[model samples]
Target: MIKSQVGRRYSKAIFDIAEEKNQVKEIYEMLNSAMVLYRTDKEFKNFIRNPLIENEQKKAVLTEIFGKDSSENLNILLYILDKGRINCIKYIVAEYLKIYYRKNRILDVKATFTKELSEEQRTKLINKLSQKTGKEINLEVKVDKSILGGGIIKIGDKIIDGSIRRELDNWKKS
Candidate 1:
């Protein structure tokens, strides 16, 4: 099977455990923190990715770092280590966050505008998106002067391009 498929399976299994224990938010936070560490700490990243290092040693280090916080976190770490899926930690965390956000009725929307939006404009956009999707909007705003005017909003697979550039292109096509 593909690496992402493996990660998804493990993510689902871990999500089920977290849901069962009413710790979805906690687990999500833990996994996110671990992912940051994995990405930022070169030594830690190398240690986790090293095949020559014993899993027991990895488990001990992970335990010292995260075990004090939650057994569920440690269990997932140990489980992945034992299964030799430690390298898929990034995929696991991404898929887990997808599951968590879906369960929490949250949508991550990326909006690109010609300039920064005012607080009122940001809130209005978020409110509009929230009402449209029936989910809470977590808006990530960006400034792209190439858009010329208006803005482009991206939600999952959907893209709403209301920028002046797009309008001009459409008019030219006509």
Candidate 2:
């Protein structure tokens, strides 16, 4: 969250361009995939962040790893990040995704559950929530066993807590 203001400015600029081009989602997907690839491979992360590696070396490594599959516009965005010394590509990618979602009216919902949900239950819940919120959601579901039962749904900063843990705490205080 504490990314350099410089990085944020550059990211915002590129995000604006992608939005103007009507490729916001595609650009976000590309950036996200690049971040995921960088995260999953230690060597790649090291190569990008290593002070000893020159920019050319870093670019070469990135090219070899990401290949031409990375969109040219995305490459420009990455180049800015690389120049800005914001090695937290994951955060940048995630932040840009949030921007894209906000622009497109796609809400991000995190559903934490004590138990895995069935497809039917998930669909029904999401449908109801979407209707209630009046925004399309891109969900990220988590299995939080410590919830004990039920679940918590977070949209933006609001939390809908239906977990047994909350009920128990309330009961104890009462």
Candidate 3:
């Protein structure tokens, strides 16, 4: 993923500090809350995302919104966005979550399925995947009807495609 250097730098600095304080999870929650605010508040999102807005104005707006309760380190994060590096927020959050999980030795699994999975199905799959991969998986699920049937399971770089689309591709090849 192409991420702005500012995002990576800010994420790294916060990740490092959070790890040292054993507050990584808490920080992630805080960032997620901020992201939600950015999404839900029209004025807030526009102010941050508008190229016409001055960086100083954006920074001041962020401070007005979050400065008091936000950790000092977290303040730097808003600046990265103010400087027009906001596109990288998603990448930074994902990476920061990965780092947090890695420190806790968790495997973050992303499963794309044709249908919505049941709680029991998710539990069974998590158990099965844990045994196969020898890691505790934090599951992230996405439903894509285009898969037709079954799902694609991704754990880091490895992808296991059991989707019907792949089956059709193989049948065509044959």
Per-model TM values vs. the true structure: 0.91, 0.82, 0.73
Candidate 1 overall lDDT versus native: 0.88
Expressed as tens digits, the lDDT of each residue in 90-111 for candidate 1 is 8999899888888889999999
Compared with the true structure, what per-residue lDDT tens digits does model 3 show for residues 1-174?
357454566678779977787777677876776777876888788778888888788777767766755466556566566556665676667677766677677898999998889999999999999898787889999999998998999998999999999999999999
Which pairs clash (backbone N, Cα, C closer than 3 Å) in model 2?
A: none
> Cα RMSD (Å) between model 1 and the true structure?
1.7
Superposed model 1: Cα runs more than 4 Å off: 172-174
RMSD of each: 1.7, 2.5, 3.3
- The candidate, 1 or 2, that scores higher on lDDT is 1
Clashes of each: 0, 0, 0
Best by TM-score: 1
User: How far in Å is the alpha carbon of 174 misplaced in model 1?
Assistant: 4.6
